[model samples]
Target: MTSQDERRAFWEERLAADWTETGVGYRALGRSFNEWMYRVRREVFLDRVGALDVDWTRARVLDVGSGTGFYVRAWQQLGAASITGSDLTEAAVARLRDHFPALRFERLDVAEPGDTFAGADFDAVSCMDVLFHITDDDRYTAAVESVARLVRPGGYFVFSENFLHRPAQRGVNQVNRPIGWITARLDRAGFDVVHRSPFLVLMNAQVDAGTLWRKAWGGVLRAATLTEPTGWLAGAALYPLERRLVRSRTESPTTEIMICRRR
Candidate 1:
């Protein structure tokens, strides 16, 4: 098992460099890795909630740990009035602004004091794929509290992390599960749970099974040469298999979306 300091430095170093460029075999292959994964995660997430209308027009969104500004760009494309992306990595914020010149991006670590973009400046907030990086238990609490402070009442805040069936399955998810226990924290911070999508959360017991399985699946299909009908048939068959695999906590932790509104 990795020590807390080691794990913390893993992310600290990973973020110190630009990583949004990692190649992915997602739907938008020609686009950047972060962009493609953003679409995949967002679409799959919203599909669970049966929502197609995101209502992002004229909305101000603050994206925490906004590596590559994936979702920020997604919302901006949907006509959001403004999007502010904050990250610990200066390179990340720089690249995001450089690529999407129209949007606003800044460098800030909510965990650190005196960091800009600290509070009450957004109508929406999204913290994705970074909750596990917070090794300090209290830091997680602080992060959520700061997010709540930054959003207006009735505004939306979305954050996600994986969970195991039991604490014993901890190694399977690699990242931690304060996210699961924080349901009370969300309510305590005056947020109402509008929706929770428990998908990509089935693969436990296997080492990072959710993330690995997803990437392997993508890589396998990346070289596909099938026709539309063939691909559709394959998808129909594949989806059920995936469902069977993920239906049990013994299997996966691909992803999950929890949506809450500041009350």
Candidate 2:
């Protein structure tokens, strides 16, 4: 099988096993922590998108990687005129269709050759916490370009990344790319990044940090994830603090959201 097929199967198996926020998010951290992490994502996402100049209630929106239909619901809450949710894995699409029969959910692989999705240009395209999963550099470029193509000129493309200043760090399924590499890719794809803000300060992966910080953060996560109750408590205790930090910080050691306009 091709690498794309392999990646699809990998996600299919994973979502089939645990189709929850935890399944799409930090699974090792368990359900409660993952839920909290997504709560943070929701807050940051809505705050950012709500502030955009577009009138969401009249805008057509597309959410790529609609894992567990989290962002799909966000769009719905914002009263989008039309919403389409797409995922690379069949498992997610099936589940999303079942859970949200009123919405459209399709199996879409953005990196695939030619057009992967069929629709009019969207006013906003959200591919949050999804790009890094395209491990191959060529595939990543295709995905970004495809996303750019899907958005109308002057429309928004909001995504999340580590935006590392140093060299990229690759894992089995993800890559934390440097800010320069990502910006150049976006520029070539006809996107002008207008806003960069913190999404998570201490609630998720710290792929760009030093060894000591990563280890220390790992220890804290281990403690928080000891049990479901502990996870809930930890999440509750740290959530407010995390929100403050995310709001106040200009940049983060972990993941951050970037809002771009098709130029």
Candidate 3:
């Protein structure tokens, strides 16, 4: 198999085994951080999408790379008229199908074209925390183009991706690109960016730096076996502060939440 095929297989295996461990919330000290992160992201998504403007109660929604059915559940909670989830991994699709039998689930790889949503376009498409995994250059472009094609003209596309002023790599899998490069690609795919914001600046810094403050606080929590509750309390205390900081700054965010429109 080719290198790209190998990488895809790697993700399929990892996701099938346990997907939650990929994020902070699944870790022992991640309870609060995870909760805070999801809550803020939901708020940002709703605000940027103008939830009030869209009649979600009767709108068609599609979630690409819907691992673990998180965003699928979010859309359902919003009372979407219909919801469909697509993923690259059969394991993910199978599990989601079993859990949310009422909603449709399909195995889809954004890099290649197939009958996504049965060729029916959607009012809103959400591709969150999934694009960075498309490390291959050609495949990345193809994936962007494919996602753009799924949105009707003037429809919304909301996604989160790592953005840096310069290219960087986090481990072997994540290939973070500059914001200009990503925006240029999206523009070429006929999408116009309408809103953008950092998703997790403070937590990213703390985790990346392994700062003494974070280590000490975590040590104390872990030492006392207060990992879960203490972590949650800390997250609650920092949520407002982090939210304000992320909103006020726009340069070199660890991950960016962007709301765009098909042009």
Superposed model 2: Cα runs more than 4 Å off: none
**Candidate 1 lDDT tens digits, 156-229:** 88776664443423442145564456676677778888765544432212223456775765554443313444
Q: Ten consecutive residues with minimal summed lDDT in candidate 1?
A: 23-32
TM-score of each: 0.68, 0.97, 0.81
**Model 3 residue 42 distance off true place after TM-score fit, in angstroms:** 2.3
lDDT of 3 at 199: 68
Better of 1 and 2 by lDDT: 2
Name the better of 1 and 2 by TM-score.
2
Give the C-alpha lDDT of model 3.
0.73
Off by over 4 Å in 1: 1-18, 21-39, 45-54, 113-115, 168-174, 178-180, 199-252
Candidate 2 lDDT, tens digit per residue, 132-214? 98899988999999898899999999999889988998877888899999999999999998999999989886777888998
> Which residue pairs of candidate 2 clash?
none
Q: What TM value does model 1 have?
A: 0.68
TM-score winner:
2
TM-score for candidate 2: 0.97
Top of the candidates by lDDT = 2
lDDT of each: 0.58, 0.89, 0.73
Model 3, span 147-236: residue lDDT tens: 888888888888988766655454466677767888889999999998787766654433222358657655654543356676677668
